[model samples]
Each structure stands twice: as C-alpha cells, then as structure tokens.
Target chain A: MSLTLETNLEDPDAIYEKLIAMLESHEPEKALRASARLVLLLINHIGDRKVIDEAIERAALLTEA
Target chain B: MNVETGKAAWRETIPVWRAFEPSPKPETEFEQARVVIVGTGPVGLAMAIDLGQRGHEVIVLGRFDFVPAGSKAICFSKRSLDILDRLGCGEQAVEKGVSWNIGKVFWKDRSDPVYKFDLLPVKNQKMPGFINIQQYHMEDILLDRLKQLPNVQIRWGHEVTALDTSEESAIMSVDCADGAYRIETEWLIACDGNKSSVRDLMGLDFEGRIFEDNFLIADVKMKEDRPSERWFWFDPPFNPGQSVLLHKQPDDVWRIDFQLGWNIDREACIKPENVNPLVRAMLGDDVEFEEEWYSVYTFQCRRMQHFWHGRVIFAGDSAHLVSPFGARGCNGGFADIDNLGWKLDLVLEGKAPFDILESYDSEAIVTADENILNSTRSTDFLTPKSDISRAFRDAVLDLAEDHPFARALVNSGRLSTAISYPDSSLSTADADVWSGGIAPGSPALDAPLDNGWLLEKLGGRFVLLTTTPFADLPSGLDVLDIAQEPANGLLRERYDLQGGGAYLIRPDQYVAARFRQPTGAAIADALARAMGEQA
Candidate 1:
C-alpha cells in the first residue's frame, strides 16, 4: 500500500479490514495484540469509546503481556 | 422433547434429538421444513438448531468440516444464557466461557481503578456470570445438539447466492461452490453477516449511519504477567490524550489495541518492532513478546429498515450491527435465534398462524435500540470528540474516585449491563408503579420458578405468572410466582400492585409485566402483543 501514516488519517474501515485479515490469517497472539492498534485508530477516526473499548478488550488477550 | 434427568446440562436436558426426524415430502410446502437455515453462525446455525429442536423439520446449510478460529460468542449475559439453556446450549456455553467478576479501569499512566459487578445479586442469572466462548465452538455445540433432533438436515457448502423469498412461500435459489440447485420453501431467514448476499439480492434498505472509528485488532504471544481482569487505560484519560486497552484470551494469547487518536498507517502501527514500545509502556519496560497477527478495521452502528421483508427475515449482523464495545453485534443475533425458533416451529407445524413472524420486527427493533443505541451513547461519553465532550468524560471518570455510584456507572458500561427494553410492547403491563425483585415486565432470572424449575421452564413459549400466593396459571402459558415485598417502591410503582404482584415472560424471557394478583388478563395482553399476527 502506498499510503503513509499522514495519508491514512481518513480511512478507519480499510485499517480495520487489513487488521481483521491479519487476525483471521495470523497467529493468535499477534492477532490479539493488534486489537489495541485497531482500537486506537478507531478512537482517532471515529472517537467512539465503545469501539475503542472493544478493540482494547481484544488486545489484552494476547498472552498476558 | 424431555429435559434430561439428574444434574443433566442444557444440551442433555433438551430433547431436540427426537425433533430432527426426517419427514416425508407432503402436498403443501409448509409440510416440509418451510425454512432451511444455512451455517449456524450465531444467526444461521442458531436458526437451524432452535427450529430443528423445536420440531420444524428445518434444514441447515454449512460444512462442519472447517474448524473455526477463536470462540466468537465470548460474552453472553444471564438473559442470553437463559435463552440458550431453553434451547439446550446453555450449560455447555456457560461451561466453555470464563466467568469474569472484576474489571480494571486504567487511564494510561494513572492509578488503576477497580470495579466489581455482582451478577449473583440478580435472581435468575446464575454461575458463569458472563461467557466468552469462540463463535465457531458454540456453533459446533449447537449443531451437535441439532443432530440429536431427527428432522433437521444440514447442507454443507450450501452458499446461498440467489434467494427467491419473493413469493409467499419463497423459494431460495442457491449456488454452492460445488454445484447448484433451486429449493422451494415457505419462508427465508437470513442469518448472514453484514455484507449479506441474501439481504442484497432482496434490495432491502439497511438504514443507519456507519460510525467514523476504524479499529485494528491483533493477537500476540506476550511474556508479561497480567491479571485476567480486563484493563482499560485512557490516555490523557485524566486529561486529553490517546487511549490503550489490553486483554487476555485463552492460549497464552493477548489482544491489544491503541486508540490511534489519529488515523495512521496500518502497516506502521503493526510493524513488528513498532509494537514493542507500546507493549513496554503497557506491560513494563522489560516485558518480552512475540507477534502473532495484526490488522485494522472501522466501525458502523447500523440496523436494517426492516428486519423482516416478506418471508425473508434477517438476523445477526444482517439485521443489525452494533458497536463491539458491548459485544452486542454477535449477542443480538443470538436473540434472533431465540425469538424465531419456537414461533417458526409453531407455524411450520400449523400450531399457530404464520403472522407470528411479525413479532421479530418489534422485538428485534426494540432490543437493538435499547441495547445497541444505549451502547453508542456510552461510547460517545468515554471516547468523546471536541474539547467539551472530552472534558465531560474526564469529569465522569474522575467521579470514580469518590462516588461509588459513579464507579458503578463506569463499570456497568464496561460490563455491558445497562441494556433494558421496558418500552418494548412485547414487555407490557396495565398502569402500575415499580418495586423490589422485578416488576411484571422483566427478563427471567436464574433463580427458581415454581415446580422445581427456574428460568429454564419458560423457554419454548410466552408465559405469564402470578405473584400472590397462588398457582392459578393460565393454561398454555408458562407462569411464575412473584411475592412482592411490601416496602419496595420500585416494585410497587412497576406493577401498580398495592402489595402483591405477578409477572409474565416471553419465550425470549423478557418480562411482559407485573400484576397485583390478577395476572391472567395482563398476561393475555402481553401474549397478544407477542402473538400479534402469529396468534
């Protein structure tokens, strides 16, 4: 993907899709950690605590880290 | 079907195994399984399992071959478990998911705040307060239970592409990857997910705006030792800053996320090395971790204009998509299965009119609005926008320090416990006040119901109960007794009962209403709403 961190500001959907694809395809641990990233991006784009909270929930599951 | 004997679980207690018996093709379309549900993904599988168990010669379309990833239905409430128990999946579902009683709320570098939700206080909700089993695992359990039934046939690789629920007894035209065929049936129910092809083919309108938040979720192996309780760290949580959340799942796996207060490159955020700093910040300076998987996502809080279009009804994410904060999206679909199961059985068996299908609309809408909409409101408060909203949230979070009630509110939102549908017509009563225990219109509790059974007794149909010292239950409805506490104002206000009161329950287990002693008439009205056209 050509998008940089700055250019990626407008798209939360694409970000989520990419992350979901990763979680669906990768190891359980990383997929779990990525959930926090997912929530952080969402809070920035959507600013919805519910979504961010849900995302953070998935993150905490990655092997007690 | 008979409830199993002696300490038997819900799966064993339900006698669905006898219901899936094969039926001979009859003259009328309804004679056969009028509706054949595909892939019991909370929605489809639930439809097949519930209908099959209920005795509607329903067929399921799915390949039990592929093992699903993580458990999907991670969070199930007391009410949800009761619904599942009625359907025979409760014991197993409850047993499979870990019960969580305590939650930790953190604001980035701020001190940790702890909150406890005592699900035990409620009468009907029992052990395994909340469950977190994978969706696929739960589906497996439900399908196995369906196997015990005789009439339900599960068709694997049954990817239904073109649906023709266009007629009164709609015909579904499905094209599986292997081959294709046209199956003529009475009605069509779509349990498919958000991008539902079934809904698309029908050209129905899914009305609601998609929220702007994009979320990225990753599961990884980490070496940091953390409590099993969920951790919510708000950044500038006390002030104005980004947020981070961390959680633990089965298999030494952890799920973590950053509120990406600003949209950033998905790749950059997920870089193997990039995640180390965040991990160190959240876990400690010296925690070691390995990467597992990563990705990004966005949010949308939308619901269909019509949960039902003619015979093709929608359930699960197809009917509605709630923000995940409350875990409502998946749980809500399970509600659809609970709602449609018995009614479809009655109609398919000619026990009741087909109009009963209409109740799905009212019940689902109210359920979604009360649960999903309320969740969104809570989300806005925590993840506020503009300076004012954030300031307001900070103020609320700050309240947790001194006020127990404020702490309760913060915890309730996290526990996803504020969902109520008192306004639902399905939940009804005459002019009344409220009281202790529960007023007439409430969901069933895990506590005891009359005759040795608890909430499990009223699983299959709408039931009405009396509260006073009496067992004079109306025939054909499940009834329970409620002894009103004289001093409880909430109960008094709810039932309008001067002293004594009773309650009525829907098949899905929400209370219809409470009454003084005369519960029969109020029950009839509640049943009338539930029966709507179905009766």
Candidate 2:
C-alpha cells in the first residue's frame, strides 16, 4: 500500500494507527519499513504533548508486537 | 457541500452559546427519549454522541449556564482515542489535540527529570501516545458533534432536580432557574460531576475520606523557556509537604498546581491577585504573563458505593472522584458510558435482563477502588509527608540519576491508560496463562482486527482478545502487517484466550481477560462472571 499523505494526520485514530505500526514492529529496518517522522510531524503540528506521548508508546509497541 | 480550502472540514460552523434558551412548551410534551443524561461535560456529551450515533434518541441536560474553562484532563488514553473514533468526531478531536509524552517527576531541592510515555509498550495502532487538549476544547468538539446528531438534545442550564427510576423507565424533573419540567425516558445517566445532585437524590452514600491537604490549580500563559513535559515536583525531598504539577497547555499556556498543605486558606489560592507571584516562582521572574484560570480545592478519593439505584446510573465525578494524579475522574465516567450504552441497548431490545444493571455497579466500584488506590499511591510518592515514604520516593529519584534498572521501576506504571475490568461478568474465563495475561485482571492486548478496522469495533460491546502465544507465528494471522509472534504460552491458557492470548475487552475499551481456554464456554462464562450470573 502507498501512503496517501492524509491531511487528517492530527486525528487521534490516524496517529494511533500510524504509531501502532511503529510500536508493533520488532523486526529490523523500521525506518525503511514505515515513516514514523511523518506521524510525529502531524502530532507536532497539534502541539498536544499528551497525545504525542500516547502516539510514541503506540509506535514503539507496534514494532514490539 | 463546497469543500473550501483552509476551512474546517464539513464547514461545521462553531456556535458560541452565550446562554441557554429553553422552549416554551413543557419537556414532557416532547416524545420520551430513549436516554436522558444529566451534565454536559465531556462524559455526558460523549455519551450523547455515542448513543445518538448508535440510533438512539438522547437528551443532555447541561447544569451550568456557561462553559467552564481552565484545564481539565489534558492527557487522553489510547482507548479514549478509540472511543472518539467510534463517535465520528475522532478527526476533529485529534486534529485539534496535540501529542505529548515527555513527563518529569521531580523532588524538591532536586532538578526536574524527563520521562517519556512513548517509551511504554504501545497497545494499538492508529493511536498516538496521548493528546494534551484543554477539557473545554474537548467539550467544544463534543458539543459540535452532538449538534450533528439529529436525535440528540442539549438543554443547557437545565438541572435535573428530581428523578424516579423504576423497572419501567426513568422519570426526571428538570429545574431551570425559573421553572421546572418533567422528562420521562427509558434510562437516565448522571454525569453531573462531583456533588452530583442526581446521585444525592438517590440517597446513595458517597463513601471516601477527604485528604487534609488542599490543592491550588493555576493556568498561565507565559513566555518561558522550559522543556515541554508533564512535571510533578515534590520539593524539599526530606519533608516534602508541598507538591507541584506542571501541564503544558496550548499557546504558551501551562497548567500548574500547588499541593499546599491542607491547612492553608482556600481564598489565598483562588484570589486572582496572588497568582502572578506563584507563576514567577515556577517559570522565573523575567517572563510576562496572562492568567486564565486559578482555583483551589482539597482532593478526595470518593465514590458512590452503588453506581445505580433502579433505572438511573452514575458516571464521571458522580460515580467516583479520585485524586487527579491519574486523570481518572472524567475518563472513568467515559468508561461508565461505554459499559452502559451497549447494555442499555440489549435491555431495551429485550436481549438482556434488567439485573444486568448490577454489572455497572459492581464493575464501576472495582474501577473506582483501583483508581483511588493508584492515585493515592502516586500522590504519596509524589508528595510524601512521612519520613519513610519521603525517603523511599527520594531513592527512586537518586536511582533515576544513575541506575537504569531503578529508573525502569520508577517509570513502570502507565498512569494515563484506562484500566481493565477482567473480573466483571463481561469478561469470561479464569486466570489461566497468556503473555498479556500478566495479572488476574488486565486489559486484553489490542489484537489485530479486520482490514481498515481499528480498535474501535470492539467498543460498545464486550470483546474477547487472545494470542496464540508462540515464538513462531501462524501464516494466516501472521500475514497482516500488524500481526505478531505470540507473546508466550501462559497468557494463552490463563485468560482462556484462543490462539494468541485473547483479551475480553469491554465496549468502552477495558480488558475483561487475556488468556486461552481459561473456560469451557467463552462468551457465556465471561458474561455470567461480568453480570454476576454465577454464584
């Protein structure tokens, strides 16, 4: 699947799914696998530090899962 | 609909309701709605949105005349984000909310140290760490979505002065400042917050002790250079009588709390003139400031022993009011809505019995107790008055400076995540074995769902999650991009989870179980346990 550059990036579900992929990954080459920075950029745009924390945990878990 | 650039999606014009306007006709004249909710805060409004979207008529009684300001719970759990998703407002709420993870727990005489919530194990995809959104803004988003619900009604300034809950339905009497009208509904939910009049009318005992110390919460806008982190400061580590927590709100705003010893005057904190000095003390003297909110109140860990009496149920501050350390108050109310919503549907449609109401009380009481325990423990660690507790807390800070293992222990508890109710009739199976089944009752691991489906499909009903618990993965479940190697064997059997350790998740996104084959009959046993069907 190709990234659509979704504009609704600040949406919590979007951030959750994006971060989930990042969190569930345990295999090597995550950066090559998916773009975590894009997710961060979206969260950064909203300036909600709390949501950012949740997304970060989800991202890490995505990789681990 | 014209999709214009730079305009809010759906061009949803935000309404500034200066004051509430009531209809001339009596409320009883209107059709009896399916659900009538009191209080229009995040909990009530969110429930209205959920029920309305689910095709039920709802009436939301907003108690106050004005939209209350300042910071409420700024941080949200991943489960909350999922609930927001189910309500069709996830896009707007997430768009407006900011992501944050860096948090600091500091001791007095010691500098602040940052801990990242991002470092914790992620539970689901499509959700971020947590969002820092002012509670008022969250209410605004909810109100907007609520307006879109054709079947929903928001009567601001209408207080529910009296209600009669019987097996047949709920009859309510709403009192405006001037007059009152009656509302008959199939069910009534009290989200009226702490000091809830609805809970009071029911004559239910709110059992809990109030802490001797009072807290001062101040919201300020200042041009200060400090790293963005949710910080807890227990100053003068040895006799740390006072504590402070700093939450960064949007637009150069910070929510700061001073946990002054309970003996201080409450007026000394709420007085607007006294706030400036306190702001300068925290952020340094050089920064100019704009003060938005400042108030003082003592903390209490209290909850109604029974969440429901007859047809009415309680939520949020009404059901339980714990210390703010864990952000449990409003979110707990949300969990109530999630549990009650689907159950209400079942009852109205004759799929379940009226006694199912018992689960709400039993389950929510357990949740309130757990929240109180966690908050009290966190508060003790954050603001230790006793010498022993202070010393123990100091040790963690000392360890944070050098030892990695010690730091890990210090940062172990996920304070903001919503808790699980594995003991409820909603959950099935005994404690067997599974990777995610670390405890007897724990939230199910957010297992993979259907394509394009996130964790939300499980909300509004009970969900059973299971992991096969294998180092090697099955080809079918393994094929999905989100699939995982089983966590372990123990989790599979402990929760009676099939394949990977399965978790029985409640509709509001709480865990019911996390194991494999813990019971012979999956749904029946779990439902029986949740509903108190078994002896």
Candidate 3:
C-alpha cells in the first residue's frame, strides 16, 4: 500500500497545533524522546509495515530542506 | 629565496607574485563606462570576458595588483568548466588540472574505503565530473583571456572607496595606487569576495550560520604514484576523533585538509613544525614532500537577502558563501556570473527589459540556497553535534560497510553540480508532456556530437534545439537541428527526442521551454518570456 500524502485528518490544523504544543511542553532532550515515543505509538496504531516504512522514508526526505 | 624565513618558504615552490602597477588616470575627471565590475577574481574575470566577447566595453577594478598565491578552491565542478569553456579556457584548465570522477570515503582505520562512488556515473560528457586546479591558475587563465579582449580594461590597484547608486546608473569613488577617481556606469557588479567593501559601502550583510569548526588546508608538492581521486576519512588513525580530506592537484600538489575541533590555537596549527607531523602520520615517513601553502579556514554558509540593490549588483563571494567541503565556494561564484552575464548583457544592449535582471537575482539565490543547504548538511554529517548524533553517524558507517541502503545515507559533501532553477519566473511552464528529459529551467546536459560537443554549440546565445526542421523561427533564435548533424544516439536519448521534440535554450544554456511539437507562436512566446517581456 502507498503512503497517503494528502491529509485525511478531521482537523489537520488542530492536530498540528496539538503536536507543537506537546513538543513545546518538554525540555529539548525530553521533547526529542517524547516525539520518538509519539512516532512509535502512531506507527503501531497504523500497523501496516509497508505504509509505515513509506511514511518513515517520506519523513526522512522532508527533513532534507 | 631561502627556506630559513618561515613566512616566504612556500613562495619558492608556488607561483611567483607580481608587483601591483597602478592604472593610469582617466582622460576625463569623471569617466563613464557601460559596465563596471569590482574585483578581479574568477567570477569577475569571467564576467568581463563574457561581456567583452559580446563587444561590450567592460572595466574591471581590482584591489590587488597580482593574483594571490595559494591552492585555494581546488575543485572546479563540471558546470564551472562548461562556463569556462564558453569564455574560451576550459581545455587549458582541464589540461593543467587533475580530473577526478571517483571519491572514496573511509570510516575508522579501514584499509579499504567503506564507501566508493562515481561522481559522473554516466560518462562521455564534454568535461570531467570535477577538475582540481589552483584558484590562482584559474585566475591566470581568465586574466590571459581578458587581456586578449581590448574592450575589457583591467585596472589594478583600484579599490572602491564608496558607492552611490540611482535608478539609471551607479557611481563609485575608486582609490587607486596613483590617485583617486570616480566612475559612473550603467551597471555595477561586485565580486569582491566575502569581506567585500562594496557590500559594506552599500550597508549590506550576509545572513546565515557559521559552522563551529576549523579545517587546516595543507597543499604540498610531492611525487606520488597514487591515482587522482578524492579520499575522505572519518576518525582516521592519523587524526583521531576528526576528519581528513585528500585531493590530488596539478604539478604534483596534493590538497590535504584536516578538521580541527572548534577550540584550538589557529596560528600555531599552521606552523610547519606542527603541521609536518600530521602530514608524516598520514603519508608515512618514506614519502618526501615540500609545503606549497598552508591555511586554516572556518567556513560559513551565508548570503545576502537580495543579490541586487538598485543598479548595483553583487555576485560570487560578495553575494553568497558556503563551506569548502562541497567545493561550492568558487563553483557557486562561477554559477552566479553564468546566470548574470547574459542577463546584464541583454540589459546593456537594450534588447531586454530591466526587470529581466531581477530573474538573475532570484535564480542565483536559488542556487545559493541549494549550495548552502547541501554544504550545511555535509558539515552536520562530518561534525556531529552531540553524543547521540555521533552514535547515529557511527552506526550508519557500520551498516554502510555491509549494506548499500546505509551507504546511500552517507553525506561526505554532496559534491557540487549544476543547480536547476525549476521555479524561475523566466522559464515557460511545459504545455507538452514527456516521460524523461531536461525539464524547463534546467541547465542543458552536455553530450558528444559528431564534431565538438553539445554545450559548445549552445553557449553565448538563445538557441532552439529541434529534431525536425522549422520553416519559420524567431529572428534572434538560432536553431540546432538534430537531423543536420551526423548521428549521435546520446543526443536523442539524453533529450528524450525518440518521439521528436524541441527545446528553446537561454543564453546561459538553460532550458527555457520544451515542446513535443513546434508552433511559431509558442516558440515566440517562450522566447519573449525568457527575456522577461510581457507575455
């Protein structure tokens, strides 16, 4: 299965704001760890290995610029 | 020259320095020129040669009388060589320089490279992937070409003390060795390097990050039988907990760079007594070599908010700077002039509107940003910031030894290449669809033709490359019909002309527009758009 690029979120703006707020609440190191944990949780929730791997690749490519 | 004096020891082996001769006073108190370029570096010289070849009068002002000594900016990228070829000196540079297409990176004390890659995977191009030539040698070649063009005047020992600009022209007060004078010109270009006086006079400054590390560049003359290639090491035994880069140059000179941590004695590190030991450690005691040049540089990736300010423009180091890791410093500068020369020429000739110059500013900034991003990433990879980062880097290296996927993650300075201006306003959006070829706003790819090369035929003017002949084409646009030349399958393959196509290339050899089938109106519209005319 191909990774979905277009947002399927009910409220992308709210979800993005919530994610940013979550990242802002912790110290720099703790924030990194928190994000890692959040990513794992979301990966497990998605559960399809191919889609998750594609998402990971897309995320890595996005960080380039 | 005696070797006893530590300061002048390197000069004995390197190019001789000529004394500065002040230019004679202008016939009139206030001289007028069509174009005035500040700085005599490679970018400025290339700009002069281009304008001179176009039969435009150019005045180049340089603060220095002689070309500076040093093996600075050794790697000239293929795109830069292509630009130099258009200016009439590409072959000389390639002949006098060491050409390399392969780079080997080693991690830890591995006897063999953990990662080996080819810069030019697809060969048979006009120029090599990169040529390692001393900056002074490149400058000399350009200066010789400049002397041949009588329209271009090189004024040595002339420094811009101040600059004043208006909508139509720029006036600068220049102080030469003989005396001071003022120059009024239609266009003024600044190529005076990073610590540019022109940028200061205009109250402009670069905005970006400066890497917190120092690299010691040691150019040495040695007689070694090793093949010419780039060798980079991470945490090598010679310099543990650091990185080292080795590159071969002409005249048996090798450029060896050793990365020193942020906090160190800068002056003490360049001393021969201290530097020789590092060289001995890297190249065993059996090899004999003499020092050619020693420099310790801390690189920064920065550029101005805008490359142009009114009638006065900035190019090369004066406009943007990047870490030397990716060989982007001089190559980026050459790309700047390659973008600007044609635009400025058209503006001076009244052939194009003034707004066309703005495209140069935008397109060049795109190139600068690309160079900065790539060099910054390379710097981050070479010098990991934290413990976790270092661990991650080591893990990637470890995996790279056995896995090709991990090798792809290696970022030992993504060697410089031509940057594509895909978002340029001058480029006409594609109306025709194709599978794969050079898209609009990309530099033309070089290929072998029956005669010379594809790039040689395309440079210095707007050209139309078509597989089928056109009965009515624009007056100024020259056509290069594939059917006229002897068969070269690479041209058709590279341009994806299997189904037949056409491309309108800009003066700098960038694809302005491409079409599956030609229409006179579409070609004219694309040409006008590329010239920044109202479409």
Per-model TM-score versus the true fold: 0.72, 0.72, 0.88
DockQ of 2: 0.01
Instruction: Give each prediction's DockQ, rounded to 2 decimals.
Output: 0.02, 0.01, 0.06
Worst 10 residues of 1 chain B by lDDT: B14-23
Give DockQ: model 3. Answer: 0.06
lDDT of 3 by residue, B1-535 (tens): 2335522343444454454565776767689988999998888999899889989999999877668887578899999999999999999999999999999999888988889889887688999999998888898899878879999999976778988988879999987655778999998999999989999998999999988799999999999998899999999999999999999998899999999998999999999999999999999999999999887889899999999888888999999989988899999999999999899888888899999989989999999999999999999889998866665666567667876666776788999999999988989999988778899999999889999899999978999999988777888789999988786589889999988989999989999999998888899999999999976
Taken in order, the candidates have interface RMSDs of 12.2, 16.7, 7.6
Between candidates 1 and 3, the DockQ winner: 3
Screening candidate 3 with a backbone cut-off below 3 angstroms (N, C-alpha, C), the clashing residue pairs are none
lDDT, candidates in the order shown: 0.59, 0.64, 0.88
Docking class of 1: incorrect
Candidate 2: stretches off by over 4 Å: A1-65, B1-18, B22-33, B109-120, B223-227, B236-241, B395-400, B403-414, B430-444, B447-453, B457-506, B509-535
Best by DockQ: 3
TM-score of 2: 0.72
Residue-wise C-alpha lDDT for candidate 1, range A1-65, written one tens digit per residue? 22122544468888778867877775664444444334333455665666556656665776587
